[model samples]
Structures are given as C-alpha cells and as structure tokens.
Target: MPAPLIWLGAACLGLYASNKANVAYLKHHDIVDAMPGESDQKSIPVNGSIVTCGIYGVLDHTGIWYENTIYELSGKGLVRCVSPERFLGNRSGTHIYVACKPNNKVLANCLAANRARKQLFTLLDYHLFDQNCHRFVAEMLVNHEVAVTSFSDLNTFLSEFFDVPIKWNRALVKK
Candidate 1:
C-alpha cells in the first residue's frame, strides 16, 4: 500500500478507537454524549443551565444560562451576557446545548446564575487551559474556584452537583 494511504488509515483507526473509548467512559459514568451532529429538538435554555456551543466543530464553548441570556467569558477575558444569536455567532454550529436530566428536564442552580450575574463585566486573565470558559462556567455552578479545561470536566462537576446523569438538550433561546 502507498505510504500516504497507510498513514491515513492509521489516523482513521486511531480516531475510531478514541471515540469508542470516550463512549464507553460516558456510558460507565452515566453521562450522555452531546457532541455536534447529534439530532436534538430545539428548546429554550432555563436559568442557571450550563450551555455550550461548538467551535470549529472540534471544541465547545460553555456559558451559564440566566434570564434567557448566556453569560460567557469572551476570549479577551471579559465576562458578559449575550443573546443566543451572539453566543452562536461565528461558531461552527447553530444550536446551543444545555444540561438536562435523564427525563430531558433542564437542570439549573440559581446560585450559579447569581454568581454569573455578579461577575458580569469582570475581567480575568483568560488562559485557554486554565481560566477559560469551561472553568468560568464550572466555578459558577460550584460557587467556588475550580479547574475545568474542557466540557467533560464541566459535565463531571455538574453531574456531581445535581446528582444526576447529565444530558445535553439542544436549545435556541432568542431575544
């Protein structure tokens, strides 16, 4: 076989194996898979729900849902409230996903929302691996400082907070 073909095949196999491992992990933890491309009905986010949107189809940007608005930390480090359109703007996907229970009911924490509201317009030293959106959202949910580098970490925190399996509900909250 050609060298290029062999390399491509190896990469494909590695991706498949990685996906399988991730699926098994989620299932063992009672967590739902909510990666982009999954079919989900559009709904509105409830206050205090942890919401996320895909970025470049490879990453997810997280925020807190409150009063029909999303509180997110911009890359520039400013925490601000944004409409759903703004949240999804210039992103790879159009739908926003919220944390939910197995019954599809949205899970929320008012204290988290309050924390996010209080932190509005606050500036932080945004570090992609540390004080980024995932960490910000996780801290709001937990009402304490935490280290969350990705959606999986945030979901783990939320699952423990609500004591329920976390699923993602696709929502499109409008102004």
Candidate 2:
C-alpha cells in the first residue's frame, strides 16, 4: 500500500465518521428517525402557514402542505403536488419538520397560484449545492416571510432563532 492510498483511506473514514456523528446528533436530539415511520407526522393548521421539511437518505427534501396538497420539486425537474403517503414512501427513515405561523393567507395563495400555473411546473435546473430541495423550500418560505433567506440561517432559525411553533414525531429507539 502506498502512502497516498493510506491518506485517501483515512480521509474517507473521517468523512464517514463525521456523517455518522451528525446522524447520531440528530437522532439524540429527536430530530431525525433511524427508520421509516419512526417519527409520526405533525398536524398542519388549517388556517396557518406550514412548511414540511424532510430528510430522505442523504438528500434533504422539503415541501409546503397547503389545502391538503404537498408541493415539492420532483427529481424530474418539475414542481408538483404529491400525496403525503407517496412522498413518505419514496425513502425510508424520512424525518419531517413543520413550521406554523399565523395569518399566512398570502403565502397560501402564492403556493396555490404556483400550483395552478403550468409555466411554474417546468423543468428544474437542479443543482446540488446551489439549488436543491432545501433552497426551494427556503425560497418559498422567505417569499412569504415565514423563513429566513439562507438555508444555513434557516436551520438556526428552526432550531433557535424563531418563536414560531414547530412539530414533529418523537424519535423512536429500536430495541
């Protein structure tokens, strides 16, 4: 084995360890699930604003549930309303976060209009780092003044910076 190979192996192991630690932290905090359906779905208010955030595998996906429809950007590069069950079935160990705020009629209308517009449902130029599911959710929420602009900032807001209420299933530990 060459010296370079040893370094590469070490780097890979480090990355793996870091990911494991992050996952563990999330689990311990009761923010993520270890398996599918491990967490229960939180109820969305009928007259308030809500954003449903999900983590599917390594991908963090999010959507807004409005009028009983879940709007999200599909892998096919289109924004569409999908059934909650279908969305959850896409991946195991999915974690959902909901943020609810008062008087979000404007945001609700915007989402409804976007869903109705065929033009907005076109191909999405998905970029993993620059433009992804998280970005999409952030954009929608920010436009409605429900969330901060930056995704990193929003994470902080979700965890600490905001007075808005959030709901999620309790983390379950397997025996």
Candidate 3:
C-alpha cells in the first residue's frame, strides 16, 4: 500500500474509536450551559453533529440552529454531537425504536386501550417511575388536540411525583 494511504486508514480507525467512546458520555449528560428544565421539555442542545443531521432529516423537521457543526439527535433519545464523516451513517430514517425493549409492545397496548388518546399515555399506565422504568413514562402529556385541561392538575401531578417545583416551567410562559 502507498505510504499516504496507509496513514489515512490508521487515521480513520482512530477517529472511529474516539467517536464511539465520546458518544456514550455526551448522550447521558446535559451540557454545561443548558437550562434546568431541558430534559422534561424534550428540548436539548447537542454538540455532536455527526448524529443529529440525519435525525432532523429523518423526522422531516428542520430549521435547527446551533453553534457546532455535528449537533444532531438520534432515534434512541440520545442527542449527540456528530462528526462530519459519521453524519451520513446515522441517517437510517426511523427514530421511534430506541433502547426500550418493550417500547413497541407498550405503545401497541396504549393505542388499543385508548382510541382517543394517542401514544405514550397508554404505555405509561402500566409503567411506573421505578429504577427499571424511569426513562420514557410521562406522568402527564397535556395535549390540546385530545384536550387535557389542567394547569392546576399538571402542577399537582409534578409535585406529587417529582417533589420538585418544576419551577423552570415558569420561564417557558414568560415570552
């Protein structure tokens, strides 16, 4: 092999190994400047663009503004920073299937039980906020299309479950 080509292959391998390790760290952490309520709101700013570019493309949602080049959200609920080279690999199109093993089963049950209310709620009925099932189950979704009317109820719900003032929620309404 040519000297230059051999060095290129070694470089690619090094980058790939580095990215795989860093992704695990970025996915589970909130960046330094992130607001407190970002997790509950489902809004996260990711520095990794390698993963996010394809995520938006898959969801058909765009106009995403960010400072870094590789900021993208993966289907697994992992918002990550992607490298320019790895950006296209993340573009498999379906994000609904994440790490949850029973996600499909739970979602299916919910759709069957409540014809009116769509997604998540049905699955959450059987799931709880335990160590095993803490990630996806929402205590309340409050969608206008299906009409979940409760500012008071929502506040009560969070307090009872989380025991913290979802105090940052106030910031969302200010503007």
Ranking by TM-score: 1, 2, 3
Each candidate structure's TM-score, on Cα atoms with residue i matched to residue i, is: 0.83, 0.52, 0.22
Q: On a 0 to 100 scale, what is the lDDT of residue 42 in model 1?
A: 54
Misplaced by over 4 Å in model 3 are 28-51, 54-175
Q: Which ten residues in a row have the lowest lDDT in candidate 2?
A: 100-109
The alpha-carbon lDDT assigned to residue 85 of candidate 1 equals 87
Model 3 C-alpha RMSD vs. true structure (Å) is 19.2
Better of 2 and 3 by TM-score: 2
Writing each residue's lDDT as its tens digit, candidate 2 over 130-159 gives 555555565564443343423333443444
Clashes of each: 0, 1, 13
Residue by residue across 1-175, what tens digits does model 1's lDDT show? 5999999779767856665576567758786544434537455677888889888555679998888889999999999999888999988877888877777788888888999999999999998878899999888877778877776677777778788877787876665
Best by lDDT: 1
Poorly placed runs, candidate 1 (over 4 Å): 1-23, 33-42
User: TM-score of predicted model 3?
Assistant: 0.22
The residue pairs in collision within model 2 are 36-93
lDDT of 3: 0.26
- lDDT (0 to 1) per candidate: 0.80, 0.47, 0.26
